[model samples]
Target: MRGKYTIKEINRIPELLKKGKEYKITYDKDKKYTFIGCGSSYNLGLITTKMLNKNGYKSNVISGGEVIVFDKVPQTDIGIFISRTGESTETVKAVENFKKRKIKTIGITCTADTTLTKVCDETYIFEFANEESVVMTGSFVYILNFLLNGIKKIDIIKDAETVLSKIKEQIDTIDLKKYNHYVFLGYEEEYGISKEGALKIQEMAIQNVEYHEPLEYRHGPKSILNEHTLVVINSKDTKKEAKLAEELKNMEAEVILIGKGKDIDIPYNNGYETPLRMILPQYLGYKKALIEGYDPDQPRNLTKSVILD
Candidate 1:
């Protein structure tokens, strides 16, 4: 438990975000783009894909294993391979699959001088963001911020301090010991972030967690809400999501809303604001793990990268 890299990395997100702009490139709107990765990288791609498609760009995300096992690689002009350590098996292997199709491949990772750099046509390694922990944290923020920088001009680094401060202010008030179940809700990229947020708590806190679109939760998942449920709505600033937050609170479930100053105020700047939405669950997961006497940095049954046999 002496290893506290999770929170340490979480705290560096704002600084890492500043580094993202240096990597921004002009994203061609008409060219079809494909992103591939696993776990948090996949989720990062999911969010970037959402932002891209929503802004008249053609893009899609695929898990690396889907390319290796199911041959599910889609036609694309370029393939972006994501892996934190530059050694995830499926991701590194899947690069050849894209090359075989004559598609240009780009690699993104935190570490340098690894398999991903050698396999891809080019690689963007942010050695500054290389982590000392098993789980990925700041790298997700850095990489997503980098991709978002290409499509949009809003500097997230300017807003990072206020957004993270609000998240910490609200999360500190939460008695994490009282909760056992966590749920994250949103739509589109918010849903992608919800899924990633769920991952943060899942990997670090080792808790029961769920994620769904805000309205979709009522379709079936709401049946499980109890006093121990802590629901976080990555709000769309919609009337329905606001109403849903109230409904869940009435059910005796603690609720945190991250839109328009409800709990953590982040006015959605189109889809660009989605990356900052992750700070809450990241910090919450860290605090939850500490309360449970578990080490957030050293997650059990996990490693920095998944190298398949």
Candidate 2:
């Protein structure tokens, strides 16, 4: 079966991220930062904020609707608005709100000459990372990699092709039809990634997906686990996390751990390897969608961008 733009965009991630390496983005370490967007862009903000905070920079993530509807703009010196199309109404409006507050605002988008560029103080457009597909894929990694690089120099993994090949091999071995529920768990920046992982499967395959912090799963979420459940842990390679994976496996749930020496062992470099880790779910979602006889590109009742009136 021929996969649509979803698979095509997934394949382009390495090239797009490498192309982003040539560009330089300037940021103020002294300024308080606020990141605003919707959906996938909002999730990117979450990961970015966690990274920034962990590195000693003051930053926070807020949904665009919070700023537009609730006037919930946090007090900050700088604001970064993210949108793939750069025309998302709430996101553009959020940038306006930041500008009205006299905050230095930056708009990050994959498309150029967009409404977002007109509203923000500065815009970083990565046109090469733009996707033909509705669901954000390669462009998501590109923008996140670019923003992370701006804070600190990041080494874009050169072996993305090899990593993806391993993911494909792993996906082929799994009986996707056997699982009806999928759960993704992680910590800090990885938590945001887990959310995105769940969203990928939810969007592409229309599966029952959930995301939570690694340790938080035991609080109440693990009770539903059964042989039909597939759990993906975006581990930090800690002993506790590994133990949780082992425990889940013992409970009859299929577990795929993405970290050092796990099922899909991608080297964990203090969450800097997040973009590469995303490949696993992206591919899994696509393959599962095929199994369910759904077109991954054109998910039911969804559009490329959420443009509100």
Candidate whose lDDT is highest: 1
Q: Which tens-of-lDDT digit does each residue in 5-63 have in candidate 2? A: 88889988877867777888766678899999999999999998999888888999999
Candidates' C-alpha lDDT = 0.89, 0.88
Alpha carbon lDDT at 214, candidate 2: 89
- What number of clashing residue pairs does each candidate have, in the order they appear? 0, 0
Error of 1 at 145 (Å): 0.9
Query: TM-score for each prediction?
Result: 0.98, 0.97
Question: What is residue 127's positional error in candidate 2, in angstroms?
Answer: 0.9
Q: What digit string (tens of lDDT, one per residue) describes model 1 on residues 115-208?
A: 9999999899899999998878878887887888888777878788888887888889889999999999988999999999999999988999
- Span of ten consecutive residues with least summed lDDT in model 2: 154-163
For candidate 1, which ten residues in a row score worst on lDDT?
Answer: 17-26
